[model samples]
Target chain A: MFGLEKKDARLLILVAVLVAFAPFILNPFPEGSGLAQFNAGYPDLMQRFVIFGIFAIGFNILFGLTGYLSFGHAAFLGVGSYAAMWMMKLLTMNVIPGIVVSVIVAGVFSLAVGWISLRRSGIYFSILTLAFAQMSYSLAYSVLTPLTGGETGLQPKITDPRILDAALAPGATPKANLFGLEMGSSVELGMGSWLFTFNAGYYVAAIVMLVAFYMSIRIFRSPFGMMLRAVKSNQQRLNYTGLNTKPYTLAAFVISGMYAGLAGGLMVAMDTQVGAERMFWTASGEVVLMTILGGVGTLIGPVLGAGAIKYMENILSKINSDILHTWFAFLPDGLEDFVVTLIYPFIGKGWHLTLGLIFMAVVIFLPGGLVEGGQKIAKLFKRKSPVDDSPDGKTTPAE
Target chain B: MGILEVKNVGKRFGGLQALGDVNLSIAENSVHAIIGPNGAGKSTLLNCLVGKLIPDTGSVMFDGQSVLGRKPYEINQMGISRVFQTPEIFGDLSVMENMMIPCFAKRDGSFKPNVFINMLKDREIVERAEHMLEEMNMSDKRHMHAASMSRGDKRRLEIGMCLSQEPRLLLLDEPTAGMARADTNNTIDLLKQIKEERNITIAIIEHDMHVVFSLAERITVLAQGTPLVEDTPDNIKGHPKVREAYLGETQEAA
Candidate 1:
């Protein structure tokens, strides 16, 4: 209905419903229950789920379509965060300007990086991008200290002269806001023993994520997207067909970079803080993991992947030996101790081991990622249902 | 005067002289064949014409414009389309998608960020692609992946992709290379049809005498990095120098 085909429109609506009801869906367990530790309905984690989803969606435009694996996307994200912080510190506490500036700044930065890095493709292209990201990280950590606030990063301060915003009270601290509504403010609903918390910032970010997703779907179905796929498929044929591969690849890179920047700006809008660690190589790698884990080219895969990883990162790491021991306390002393010890490495501080094993399994068994798995399951159900075939065992006629 | 003119074009790589003092002109709306033995510089000459290589001491001109410094895509934009030895269609895309790409390139030029417009809704591109597929007799396989098609069908699709652009000149590099006899015959028939129907110049590099004699109105015999003879098919077959350089051994074997 939104200028999308029926299939794509359905998918978009499904995602919108899921995101809108995430607070209730994520917090399934009642308050003070034993399983409450697994609840992921917190506003902070929900924001991250959508933010990283945007990052991976953008990355997919480059890696999935154009087949350019950029290892330096985090540099754009970091630059975006720093730009948003400076805007907040100087202009006002309002997030609209900060977010807008963040995208533009990141676009310019990525344009320069893409122009240089796109010269060499394949492994050389990957290494060039990696080198650029590392250089940016180093500059932010050391040489560009005055601008980036060095390794310490930047934040809004009461003493700073905010040209567009009024002075803060003597005893009050600055908070990032949209108009008069603070990002951290939330509404709580208590029904019997179950409790649901909904935050203003989470809804704001969710709306942005929905728009980003809709735009990505349009791009995937557009003529430009087909060209990007051509660039990936047979660049030589494309060149001989009178199409320039350089500009197409460069445009994809810059568009993806701008997506990463928007994600970075959103992070500051939600938290009112910026850090150089946001641009770390591992952060860049995490987006790649999310994309591959969900499904590289599918529209909804990145968001699912981001949610899966963030859920595991938050909930799995919270499980300790004590929690494990309590679950097995009914067993004898020695048996409980042994079980706790055996499971300890896979949880808490060693949760990465579990994540790594899951990643390996996804790459091996589900090469097309979780989306393929879901499709297989859907096919199984469709096969079981032969009601559509006919009442007398004859198949339906072809249209 | 011909549409394409190669004047004293010479190219060398290290100690090996790939092409030397080559001069040729391909007339408009004619099927021209370049026949040669292995390492005879036919491919090298073709590469020089398509902007893949710059000549050491000559000019390759198409329609009175020098094509030396231009990129391959720019050269293509100037009304030249090339088909590779192996069918070079986008293997991962569907047959319809492969045809639409060139149509888009023709309509939108080298690069256009029509990122928001729906491809299916773009009536011009869709109609052109569908018409070309129908013209190529592949409308039934429109949704099938291009890579899964047979070798003959792949070659047909590639030729259709080239024709969809309606370039002034079409270059075919060993169009029937590594094909079964039936597929080769099918390709020759397709090329013959293309030549008859379109007012386009066709330059083909081939090892098969059957294909050359069937399609080429004028023949150029190249041997050891130079043109040994350029004449009509009947005259080329009777030329003593052409027989010595290439045709004699093949005629004896046949």
Candidate 2:
């Protein structure tokens, strides 16, 4: 059972199945149809799903269990991407070094920040983290421009010496690879108007995400997780019970930072690009939004939230007036224009408005997030379930 | 030597002296009760003993080590556990989880980052916690949420949690405060049983004379940030000095 409890092991299997078949599930539309634009089975978007999922999962380790809401987590992600980009530039295009370097760099950076920021809890802790992140972003943009490539971003170049990699096939640009397998390599299968892409990059990210999810489950059930939860619940009691809570919390913060770094590294491995804007404060807020919208403390909630937000950003934002006009073409001429105008604000440019409304609804109605919604549904089913032919099939909601 | 010794401990805030020239010695394996009206510095003295407050002058020695400026967790590691006035149990955890935290602290020392180890398989810790729950008669409430329990139950769980750490000295700050008569008597019995069955010292600060007389072997009366008298419980009842200081009676001519 991989050292997991029966319940956790079952959950892992279910997630594995879901993640493995996501390309098929997300691409229900035909390629030539009007709805083809909504397909998320493409390599670029699929890689994003797994990458951001890792980011949110890592954030949950700190914020969910320990109740420390970090507003500067994106700094770690940005630092990670920058590190990965440098690894690819200076070393080989092999992503292992890039990933390893990013995780290590982000861990060290987070340790420094967590050490200082963790001195205070609640609002002060949040402000200190925010300040640290802003400092990192400012440094990356201005002072560290040589290292970070300034506003243009650090990108891989053909002239750089990739010590581990042999001379490339003549006149070819570098791409991230695992051994000899190119990360951008993909296999496209088409049946009639239906098209599905199985990308080597997407699979790598998915496998990494699966491992990260499994590790998160282990942490969630470990005695260490109990201690983290104790830190969240009553740190005073823990301290009095002869436990130093600061170190435990710092470990969580560092772990969360490393997760962000892994996500960042994966992003580069897929797109082979790293931008300073990824480390911006708003980007940090986006991960926070993902974790909260999914469910603050639940294991699968953050991944679900990350996927939801990314999908909305990618798919919903593509709905321009042209798409709206086509949908409303069946209506009368005056009503068709009116409907398109009415729907214009929330799609494309105003997708943030839709996302904001969803975030608010999750916070207000489902404080426990999407996980709580699932639990409520499960509870309802449990209440309605009847006994199986036990002389009398007498089971009502009252029981 | 006393298990806990406080010599001339004084704490001042701006213009007021919260604790002034306070000296106390709690002998090993004895129950000592500190009784005072509000603002008489009983709680202040208790805070000093646990390292929550550092006295401006004087030393607090527990088991021959200076407890001054040590963190509360360090103080607890030296075999002193405190039960708070408001029942400070972890509200987000289950009753069993709450019970096991002190066990982890005691067995693993002050800190260990033992992450990735399955807690469900921790056999020794589980048995110890279950045994403690059985002693507290809370075995049925093991899976219950600690926060959802009644106040009396919370107090019971908190006390049980303190005992599981196996501290040499237990400090109770108004253990029976704000409880109904029935719950108060239950707590009294629990304390009486603990004192008889274990080789542990106890220091209790209380406003209730009933609880003080029931458990205290020696009683110290405080008034205006100083000890007025120290005597046995029986003699402390009608002692004229104690009567005048505690009851606000005018002293008659000697």
Candidate 3:
């Protein structure tokens, strides 16, 4: 069946339950515990995890299915953010309008870019998209200062009116309120000394992420997705067989762009700010990294990559030399010092180097990333392994 | 009346002339086979016809309408469908999914954007696809991933994809070029069935003489980017110029 299977439906429900309980799971430390350096319970970073998960998932739709590597996806995110901010400034702070505007604007932008880029295939298409994104980034930084607010970015100001809620002052900050339901408010559950807090905002973002996830699953199952895969495998054959694969590829590109825009809009809703830096090529590269790290074509892979990278960025960076020294105090004083210093380069700003090394290692050895590794391990546990390197029983050409 | 007319089509790549002053007229509902030695511009002519390459000077007409400067998909929408030399089925998708795509394209003029609605419930599209697969004897492999199938099966699935569209004109490029003896025989039988059942004009470029004789009503021999002879398949086999142009040294014996 082209629709979700029973197992898939069950898996989705399990994932939803886990996401709903993320705040409680992450906020496990005692209130004033001195060892509470790794707190992933915060709303800001949780929103980031889900939003970028959406971005990487969208990117995988284009690159994974079509084999068209785009290096300019950040431009879509930036455009979406700007569109969302404009919605906040003009209309209500309600996220519905903001998300709608973001998706529409991003889709239009992707259509224009896809039309020109599709004129050429392979590396030329990649370079063209990169050039377009760079052009957009520069325009946002300088020429379009009024709309983008230049390097300062567009932010909520004290004087901005809150038309939806008159009780709030004109200068007051806008919260993500859905029909008078406060987004920032949390539900606290206590059992003796133990406590758990779940923010309404995180749940909202989680729900949106789930919807995005479901939509992606549907797209992957549709006939349209099949055409995109055909285009990737053999364009000449597709053409000769009477299929015009261009429109199909363009459709995929637009759908992905809309997803990226939705992610950007959610980001702005969570943070109340949109920055020009979001459009940088490095941001674009990060999404690619996430997709590849988890597994490019796999369904749940990008989410894992997003969570892993974001967790490392937030938690691992906080581990200073002092904390390391305390953990290894049982060993000799000088040996502990040597060990901490030895691992110091890989923990903070050096984290990216570790990621790069890991990426290269994965590319060289496990080209299919974590998904393939997991499959291989599963095969090892089972006595009978498949005949070929392909995880599924197919003779597909390697990328 | 010329259902498809190519007038004064000339294509050049820098200094090399791929096609020069080439003209062709396709009668409606006729199976036309274009045969040639290697590098006789057979592929270039097909490319020009399908809007893949723009000729330096030429106009291509389909159903008395200009086909030049139109996008390939737009041309497909105008009742033209193509099948490549190699099988081009979606590797990840099942055989049924591949068939359903062209059925969608045929039923709906453009793509349907209501992605939220489940596609499996669309019984009409499914039934059409099933019928096409049955026509190709591929209904048994409907749930199998296309990439996992044998070469013969893959070709069958691809043919089913094109047939689902129900195009007025079908283009095939070297459809039987790489098949084994058994597969070739199977393909010959498949082509015979397709021509008999579909009632559509098929324009094919084939290196296989067996395939050409199997389905093609008329045959055109090309040499050095020009049509040397166009006649019935039986006449083409006996024609002196076609033998001389295609067989080379064997022309004296003929």
**Each candidate's TM vs. the true structure?**
0.96, 0.96, 0.86
Docking class of 3: acceptable
How far residue A27's Cα lies from its native spot in candidate 1, in Å, is 1.1
Q: At residue B71, what lDDT does model 1 achieve?
A: 93
Per-model clash counts, in order, read 0, 0, 6
Q: Lowest lDDT 10-mer window, candidate 3 chain A?
A: A389-398
Those runs of model 2 whose alpha carbons end farther than 4 Å from true positions after fitting are: A384-399, B247-254
User: lDDT at B50 for candidate 3?
Assistant: 78
- Provide interface RMSD per model, one decimal: 7.0, 7.1, 4.1
In model 2, how well does chain A match by TM-score?
0.95
lDDT (tens digit, per residue) of candidate 1 on A143-231? 89999888778989998777998888789898989997898999999988888999999998999899999999999889898898888
CAPRI verdict (incorrect, acceptable, medium, high) for model 1? medium
Candidate 1 colliding pairs: none
Q: Write the per-residue lDDT of candidate 3 for residues A236-306, one digit (tens) a residue.
A: 65554446677778888898898899989888877788988999999888888888887777667778778
